[model samples]
Target: MKVALKIGYEGTHFSGSQIQPDKRTVEGELLKALLEIGVITDTETADLSSSGRTDAGVHSVSQVVTFLTDNPRMALPRILNSKLPRDVWAWAYAEVSDDFDPRRHAVRRKYRYVLNADEHDISKMRDAAKLFIGEHNFSNFAKKDKNNPRSTVRKVEKLDIRSQGPVIKIDIVANAYLWNMIRKIVSALTLVGNGTRDIEWIGKMLDPDNYEEGIEPAPAYGLIFLEVQYDPEPEWMIDNYAIKHTNDFYTRESNRFLVISTILEQFVMQPEKGQDLD
Candidate 1:
């Protein structure tokens, strides 16, 4: 059977999402678990695909993946969860078409950055987010590609600011992102919120032709892959039972994930040890 999976992970410990030699990585761990659980005989024949790539230290709540598998049984998510490590989870799965590719079918991607709101003005950040609501050139926000360059113009569907007790969550939805793009934009928005930079500075960065310098990217720990939206809603997503089942899975994870406690430990204890559930 061909299967699609909804995965969530704390990325603090992995080198990045991709598999590389001699590094702990999200994809590597996942494949290891799959092999051990008899999901596949070998990595080369699994035919795996992911919705997108996430940098090191970036978490995910609903990252998606698809793979061609011969396993005939259902409830793969629950089974995969059993074999995976504590920080990585497989929450939902459904049979999918052979042609469905998570990367190609996705229409939009959502990311959220959780920042310490105690030191910044939330009102100013709200105003600044409005400036990014349309298509703009973001070359200045990411690393320049000298060898194989892609277009810098991208569309922002929405940018929302939500405040909690001491944390401010900035949610950004876009067609896609360039390398370090969200971090750079968050760095700019934070400066505006902190009253260190004028709002016009954001407008200046939108100038299509010129790529500016010196805007530092935000810490990777604060960012997360929230979800992925598809062009035509997939059949698996329309199932009410799947929705309720995934919700139940999420609630179970919340009780055991200890997301907030892990972040606090990173802030208070030895972050260098990298055992804080990456």
Candidate 2:
């Protein structure tokens, strides 16, 4: 049987999503858990694929991963959750077609970058974000993966910037993303918001001739894997409404943090101004 899993993880503790030889990673931990439960003997026989690879310190709310197993006795979510780390959990599972490939079958991938802008100008950042919507060669915005043979041109369906108090959330939906693309875009927007870079700088980076010299990648902690979209629904799954509710809960939590952050920023800024009066 082939199972499709909806997985979530706090990437702060791991090296990254992909399996590393000696380093701790989400994939490594997951495989260990599976192996402990007798899911498969080793990588040579086990088949596993992830929707996408996230960089170190990035988090995921809904990540899709697929694995193959011949064991009929295994109850996926129950067994996997028991053996996995506290930070990583399997939320949902389903029997997918053997032909289904998590990476190739994915229609779209969504990513969100949450930034603590503090006193930065959000309006300016939004203006800069407009430049990212549409198809473009994002060589400047992503760390070139020397192993990847595919073209860097990606179609971005949406790029939205919204401010919830001191935190600026940048939501982007695209067919695919190159390595470090979201982080680099966030870095550019932050620089613009801080008045260090203008909109013209963004334009220059999009131009293939000038791109390499113009952009810098941001830190990895701010990015999150928001979701993955597929065409036809797969078989052997839980109710779709349950998944929707789970995502809604995440949105509520984000909003709650925004409120607290706004209050803290105001309190901190006021005391500094009061000191000058004294």
Candidate 3:
């Protein structure tokens, strides 16, 4: 039987999503768990694959992974969670056809970037984000592959910027993305937000054939692969117990980070408005 699982992970310690020799990775951990549970003897025979690839330090809330397994009963989310590490968990699953390819069947991919809104002009960033809503050549905003170069033109179905408390959230929906596309877009939008660049500069970037400028990608830690949409969505079986466990794990992680952030805030040096510095 062919099965698909919706997995989530905190990618801080992972080298990346893909498997690498001598490096700890998300896929490596997942395959290890699968092996430990006696799901499959090898990766190739199982036909393991994932919806998309995420860079190191980039997190995900909804990543789809598919594989062929003879023992479907042992592949429950909660069952898998028992052997999987705390940082990575499977919360939902579905029975998919043998020919179903997660990446090829995906119609839309959504990503979210959380950024500190301390000095950014939210209005300017929103305006700049709108410019990326339609189809355009994104060569300037993406890192091209030399070995297998593909078209840089891609359509942005939605690009929204919202502010909450001290952070701003940037949500982007697209058909597909070129390498480093979202991070570069975030870099450009942030530049506009911080008043380093103007809206015209963003417009010029879309026309890479006429105007071109290198854009450094934003930090991968800020990016999150939120979800992937398919034409005929899978009837995922939600594992309530698995989800509860995931929430518990997240709560612990959240509290730890909150404390660390609070401590770091106290260490930030700032001068008083009327104080003179020698």
Whose lDDT is greatest here? 3
TM-score of each: 0.84, 0.84, 0.95
lDDT of 3 by residue, 16-65 (tens): 88888999899999999999998877888888899999989999999999
Better of 2 and 3 by lDDT: 3
lDDT of 2 by residue, 64-142 (tens): 8888788734636656777888677777778888899999999999999888868679899888889988999888887
C-alpha lDDT values of all predictions? 0.83, 0.82, 0.93
In model 3, the clashing pairs are: none
Clash pairs of candidate 2?
none
Ranking by TM-score: 3, 1, 2
Sorted on lDDT, highest at the top, how do the candidates line up? 3, 1, 2
Query: Which residue runs of candidate 1 sit more than 4 Å off their true CA positions?
Result: 72-75, 237-278
Q: Model 2: how far is 210 from its true place, Å?
A: 4.7
Best by the TM-score measure:
3
Error of 1 at 147 (Å): 4.0
User: TM-score: which is higher, 1 or 3?
Assistant: 3
